[model samples]
Target: MRVRKLTFAALAIATALSLTACNDEDLTGQADPSSTSTGSSAPDDAGSDGSGGSDEEGGKGTVAGTGSNENGEIGKCRTDELEITASDATIGGDTEGTVAVEFKNGAGRDCALAAYAGVDLGTDSGMISAERAGEPVDTTILKDGKSIFFGVTYPMNDSGGSGVRVTSLVVTPPDETKSVSIEWPGEATLPVTDGGGSSVKVGPMGSAGQGEG
Candidate 1:
């Protein structure tokens, strides 16, 4: 009878030990929710023209004009009503076309259009090319100026021929050559052609300043 009791006790002890081992195993080899990865491994999805890559991809925004320094402690100048007026552009049958570029001024100070403002053809990203137009525009600025115009080129629609995109219109006085940009109104609405006659405007692209909030 004692042996029977001992045998029953041993069986119970064995069952408890097995259960304890199982509990230990469950605790030690547990899968943790925090141990898993969560993110995508795909290629960076950028703008089709490879111009609209994210900040991580090294694309920020198009920079134009000098920054604002209202205090003038060697500060920058800013204007609220700098603008451009573009006429209908016609290209092809030649290596150029003609488009009129104008810089409309709304600043209180006298501002002239410099010789290096970019009137280019824009792409998927804010990439612009100096299309039919000639050199930098020359704005004739006076105090409370209005509009200044420059005539661009009339190039033929080559396969990779893009139309016209204006980067920036700037002004520099006689003493200083560093350009001060005229703020463009709205966004760039150019007509560009991919040398193959496939064309589109390069903008509504973002700028370096305030967010779209």
Candidate 2:
């Protein structure tokens, strides 16, 4: 009976050790439901790439229609904004004479002129339109308080009896309908028939030195 008690005690101790090991394993293996996760869920930074470098580098490039000009807008010049005048331009080159016409920008803003200015010589009979001379290669910008120039060419008549007598000039800006009238600088008689072609012709608009005179 003493030997049986000894074996029972040994078996009880072994069972108690096995239960303690199982409780330890259960405590370590199970995850806590209330605790936060270790993995990140935040969004990536906008300026940084994954390699820790920035995505953007420099300033913006130039945009369309925004040039070096002030006010950043360019449009056709209007007739009402101009102060038109005429003067006697020196005629020296090929053969014929030309009248220098200048357009001053009194409008406090900027504008542009392309192609020829429409010109008409006012006579007692009717209005005679002058023909356009050259093709427009560039758009002339008339800045605030600036002036643009062009020329009106005509055949110089040694014998003055053939052509219509012109007393005033009715001028119109490019791509404009309304007209402005200025007195003719000198007496001119533009012929109605000059070798079956138009007698009067106007050239393209230009800056100061590039004018016809």
Candidate 3:
């Protein structure tokens, strides 16, 4: 009975040692929540520091008409900075004729222009009305020494018994109040219906060398 107790006590001591080693192993295997990684890292945000890289693409970088005058925005063409001239009239047939009016930019800097020019064809009696022949083009950037042309077409008949002779032609550039006048180029005249107003058609402004008629 004493030998049996000694063997049982030895087995109990071995079991206690094994349980202590297992507890130590479990404590070592546990991870700290703060230092452990959960998943993949997040991506970085771009251009959040107010740099100009993204602002340029979004059209918010620099304001126009700022800094140097050369770099500033371009304004409308002024009358003082332009040279106006007209071509001789060419009769299409017995009924219609066309003449081209040219505007040359004489300014030291660039400017912008668009739309049809205002024209006044006056006879000995009174002023004649005119209308735009076609739609206006997009805004044209006129650099120094550049030019644009527009055409004016009118009735050329003088044998309608009420035909009035055209003597002078007055031209005003777009967005300008001042006007320039020159003598008529040809002998074209318009028919006056029962003393009513006569009409001429003007084309939209375009680059030089283009077909104006």
lDDT of 1 at 210: 16
Instruction: Rate residue 32 of model 2 by lDDT.
Output: 42
**lDDT tens digits, residue span 76-182, model 2:** 88998999998877446646667788988878888888768899988775777789886666777888888878888777665657667788998999989999999
All candidates: TM-score: 0.32, 0.62, 0.60
Worst 10 residues of 2 by lDDT: 54-63
Tens digits of lDDT, candidate 1, 1-213? 999999999999999999999999887666443243222212243343355544435522222122333323331123344544555344344344445444455675655433434444433446444422223333333335545444444334344435354555333322343544444332344445456632322111111121011
Per-residue error for 67 in candidate 3, Å, reads 5.2
* 70: Cα error in model 1, Å: 18
Q: What's the distance in Å from true for residue 210, model 2?
A: 6.4
Clashing residue pairs in candidate 2 (N, C-alpha, C atoms within 3 angstroms): none
lDDT, ranked from best to worst: 2, 3, 1
Once model 2 is optimally superposed onto the true structure by TM-score, how far is the C-alpha of residue 2 displaced, in angstroms?
25
> Each model's C-alpha lDDT?
0.42, 0.74, 0.73
lDDT winner, 1 or 3: 3
Worst window of 10 by summed lDDT in candidate 3 = 37-46
Q: Residues 1-213, candidate 3: write the lDDT tens digits.
A: 999999999999999999999999777666443234332221122344444457775554245433445575688888878898888556445467777788888998788876767888988778875788766677777778888887787776666575777889898888889888977775556776574544588877872235332
TM-score of 3: 0.60
